[model samples]
Target: MLPPDLPPLPALTRAEAELIDCYLEVVDLLGRINPARTEHTYGGLRAAQALVGRAAALRDALAVMHRRGESEVHAPTLARALRVLDGERRAGRLALPPSPGG
Candidate 1:
């Protein structure tokens, strides 16, 4: 189980933990049976991939914000905002506003 305060991974958010557990179960089963025999049939794998992207973005943002002196009081919320901002920047869909006193 994950810590209670932090936001859950999207795969663990929109779906029950049991669903992810089931996916992991299948993945484990395939790993044990014939690792090369199975392939992802649908978006569960895609969603898993996206979730990894999101978590990576969030982690990078948290590191950046921490370096920029965003205190812990604001870190968690700012982490989420910065993750979204970074996503938009990557997608060429948005620009970040100038920092104060910049």
Candidate 2:
């Protein structure tokens, strides 16, 4: 059985770690946005659009890392990013948003 608190094994390469950091920053930035403000302010909307775009690029980067046989330590991070992008029309690929009351 896996350790409940353990992260994925086999550590990240320098490049992979950089990508994860970028992904995390964008995710954190989006979390700071207020949905009501985004609907009204130009800057807020643009930030949301940029956040959505970066999430897609991160997905592609994760795919490349997978092809190169890196450890799956970033999987959970990617999943969180996807959920943030979910229901965002600008985000490419199929994304299912979190269910209500979930």
Candidate 3:
């Protein structure tokens, strides 16, 4: 059962949902990769490990945000989506993309 004090999760935007879906797909594919089917390269293994760690961090951050009532559920015209992304980035749960001018 959900904790009694926890707030309901914010509804996902289409973009947010799509991002999560794509991220999960990569995570799942890496998880199901057969060692026998892929070349035994340390680089691939390292990347997979990094992705697993990042995915865990992202999941945990999302849960904490939900429980703390720190979500975009009612902000129809504000920064719920940006807030989630920025909060996660600031907390080291996710990385911000490089700037176009950088």
Candidate 4:
């Protein structure tokens, strides 16, 4: 059996969409580079390197939005979009694991 279809993404301005995509990319790279979760230095190093570019893109996206006068963030709408995009799970990789037994 096939899985259910995902809900449609909320309507967003082009700049807002770009911002969300760039933000998620950076978050995913950071998650991969998280020291507590990474299994190998080389893998984390690669992620960190990629993070430099992703972070730049994220910055650029914000700059574009700001220059376009999108000064106010619609947090509720963006949060809904993030939830639709599995951002919570992707970001969870950044958290430290629970210490042994407590």
Candidate 5:
């Protein structure tokens, strides 16, 4: 459960919500597949396999928004939603860890 002190999620249209959900799903999968972070290839392979569908879903979500004339992304609002959803930490997994000796 999210902490009570976290800000409320911004209101979003159905397509927008779907887009964000799909985007995060892809992010999570990529994080799992990060070679710098993963200890085994099998798990990363599974996540990599799953990433294809998630990427398609993310594409479809954007297409839906485009068809609905929501051409512009409201970055500030979406950033707030991402912050509330722990996107920073999730995305951080994509980065390589600091060098052990440096």
Candidate 6:
């Protein structure tokens, strides 16, 4: 049985899938590190934690943007892609290129 007032589910894009994968990886890492109780000792762990938080926030933001029915297709798509890439970068799965000035 379905709720009559509920809207249909939106189709997730490939970018969204990648974002989800990155998120899952971060979650797994967090789980592994949590028991060690060594987050304070390692800079990478703390950074990873921050990345998790940021990724979560980005996910929430994407959902809200999706629900708002914004007519600008490009905005939503770009936002979606960026969020995924950001998560990947944070997770150390993707290395960011050096800045031009460097």
Indicate the worst ten consecutive residues by lDDT in candidate 5: 2-11
- TM-score, candidate 1, is 0.32
Those runs of model 4 whose alpha carbons end farther than 4 Å from true positions after fitting are none
lDDT of 3 at 57: 60
Clashing pairs in 4: none
Report lDDT (Cα) of residue 48, candidate 5: 95
Q: Judging by lDDT against the true structure, name the best candidate.
A: 5
lDDT string for model 4 (18-91, tens) is: 99999999889888889888889998899889989988888998899999999999999999999999999988
Q: All models: lDDT?
A: 0.41, 0.57, 0.51, 0.92, 0.94, 0.53
Q: After superposition, how far is residue 66 of candidate 2 from its true place, in Å?
A: 0.5
lDDT of 2 by residue, 33-98 (tens): 555324356666676778877777777777777788875666665555444444233332123445
Top candidate (TM-score): 4
Q: For model 1, how does the per-residue alpha-carbon lDDT over 27-51 read when each residue is reduced to its tens digit?
A: 4333333323334544445544555
Predicted candidate 3 versus true structure: per-residue lDDT over 3-99, tens digit per residue: 4563343576554454454455444445434354356677567757677766766576566657666575434422344444343343332333456
- Alpha-carbon deviation at 72 in model 4, angstroms: 0.5
True lDDT of residue 20, candidate 2: 59
Q: What is the lDDT of residue 40 in candidate 2?
A: 52
For each candidate in turn, the TM-score is 0.32, 0.46, 0.33, 0.95, 0.93, 0.34
The runs of at least 3 residues in candidate 2 whose Cα sits more than 4 Å from the true structure, single-residue gaps closed, are: 1-11, 36-40, 74-102
Writing each residue's lDDT as its tens digit, candidate 6 over 1-102 gives 974554332456544544455555555455445533343547556656677776775576556547666333554654454454454344443433456799
Off by over 4 Å in 3: 1-11, 14-33, 68-102
Ranking by TM-score: 4, 5, 2, 6, 3, 1
Per model, state how many residue pairs clash: 0, 0, 0, 0, 0, 0
